[model samples]
Structure formats: structure tokens, C-alpha cells
Target: MTKCRECGKILPQEQRIDICLDCSRKKIQKRFRDDPELKDVFKKTIEELRKPENVKKMAEDTYRIVNAINEMRDGR
Candidate 1:
């Protein structure tokens, strides 16, 4: 058995889906309706991380991006 990550609802193994089916469906619908660029960015990030030579660069870039995003969120 597994539990929903978001709601913490205990469910049987077959009944449990990643992040719970409801949360996953809502997330998918949200991705389709808004913030579609996030999907592309995630794919690009993964692709970059897969290359050995790009690992360090990707880590640094991710750090910078995360900091910038956090700063923006904090209204810095």
C-alpha cells in the first residue's frame, strides 16, 4: 500500500497512483491550461543533466536559476 503524497490518504498499491490520481490529474490539467513552458524547461533540464560534460554546468545553471526564481518570488 501507498499513500497520496499531497493528501496522505492511505490506499492500496493498485489504487495508489503517483501523487494520487486526483492530484496528478489536476496537475496535468493545469499544465495543459497554463505554464506550458514548464514542461519544455523540465525536458531541457533533464536532457542537459544526462550529458556527463554538461552535469557541472547544469548544476550551476540550476542553482542560479533557482536563486533568481526565489529572489523574484521574494520580490527582491
Candidate 2:
């Protein structure tokens, strides 16, 4: 079994990546936090995502996606 390089977590048999998803996510977040430019961009992006208009749009999009999945499952 493959193991995560950073956390030593055993990876699934078919997983091709060296690191587990959780550890990779943490590493990416740490990089964004440590880099000043990336930190600012990430902060701004999060702020934009939190805006009411964006939140509403995201919710609507999620609903549409779920409905689409349901339709597909129902053979529509």
C-alpha cells in the first residue's frame, strides 16, 4: 500500500498520488498562508465567496447540480 509522504497515512490501492488528500489539502493551505501574495489573493477570494450575492448564487448552483444528478439517476 502507498503511504502519504507527509502524514504516513496509508493510501488506497488505486490512488496514484504520493500524499493523501487531507495532507495535500493542508499543505496547499499552509502554502497559501505562508506566501504573502497568495495569502492576499486567497483572503480576497474567500471574502468574495462570502458575499451575499455570491452565496446565493452558489446555493442556486448547488441546487441545480443536485437536481441534475437526480434527473440523471431517474433516467430523465
Candidate 3:
């Protein structure tokens, strides 16, 4: 058994998602409905992170995403 990261719900082994299922599903739907480009950016960033030669670029991409999210939050 494990606790969900987002909701802190205790779940059986099979039910344990990286985040709670509810949170994960909500995030998935949100990604599809709004800011779909972020989904692609996350995928590409993960792929880049997996490659040793692209690690620096991965960090740069992550920073860009973080800044973009922050800007959106700040209504900039």
C-alpha cells in the first residue's frame, strides 16, 4: 500500500498512482482542454532528460516551462 502524492490517500498497491488517480485524471483532462502544448512540452522534456547529451537542454526547457506557468499564474 502507498499514499497518493497529491491527495495523500492510502491506496492498495495496484491503485497507487504517482499522484492520486483523481488528481492524475483531472490533470490529464485539463491538459487536453487547456494548454495542450504543455503536454507536448512535458513529453519532449522527459525524452530529452533521458538522453545524456541533451541534459542541459532538458534543464533549459524545464526552466522555460516553469517560467511560463509562473507567468500564467501571475496573469502576465
Candidate 4:
């Protein structure tokens, strides 16, 4: 067994996550289950972003969205 790096909780040997696993799962499941519009937006965005011609733009957009999400979480 080892300790989780983020929360400093004891975890089983097979569980190698750094952060709070249960908290991450709960937030992921809740977002996927409850955010229909966001899901559709992601689906469409993925399709558009997958094209070879869109690679640079996709990277830029990915960074922007990730930074925005991080900021939102930090604010909370």
C-alpha cells in the first residue's frame, strides 16, 4: 500500500493515482451524467478538432479551455 500524493490518504497498491480518486470519479461522473449540452459541445468539438488541418488551432483551443477550467476551479 501507498499514500495518495494529493490528499495524503492511504491507498491500495493497485491504486496508483496521485490525487483523491473518489473525488475525481464523483466529479467526472456527475459532469458526464448531468451536463448534456457540454457533452454535445465536446462531441462536436472533437470531430472538428480531429482533422489534420486543424491541429494547431486544436492545440490552442485545448490550452485555452483547460486554462479556463483551471481558473474556474481555482476561483471556486
Highest lDDT among the candidates is held by which one?
Answer: 3
Write model 4 residue lDDT over 1-76, tens digit each, in one string: 6765546877655554443455444443455476454556555766887899976555345434444544655776
Model 4, C-alpha of 19: deviation from truth (Å): 17
**For residues 1-76, could you state the per-residue lDDT of candidate 1 as single tens digits?**
6776668877555552435545544544455355455566656665876699875455345444444444544773
Ranking by lDDT: 3, 2, 4, 1
Alpha-carbon runs more than 4 Å astray in model 4: 1-36, 67-76
Clashing pairs in 1: none
List the lowest-lDDT window of 10 residues for candidate 3.
56-65
Which of candidates 1 and 3 is the stronger one according to TM-score?
Answer: 3
Ranking by TM-score: 2, 3, 4, 1
| Residue 10 CA displacement from its true place in model 3, Å | 0.9
Local distance difference test values of all predictions, in order: 0.54, 0.56, 0.57, 0.55
| Cα displacement (Å) at residue 68, model 3 | 18
The CA lDDT at 26 in model 2 is: 63
lDDT of 2 by residue, 4-75 (tens): 777998977766566665664465465555544545644565576577877644433433433444454477
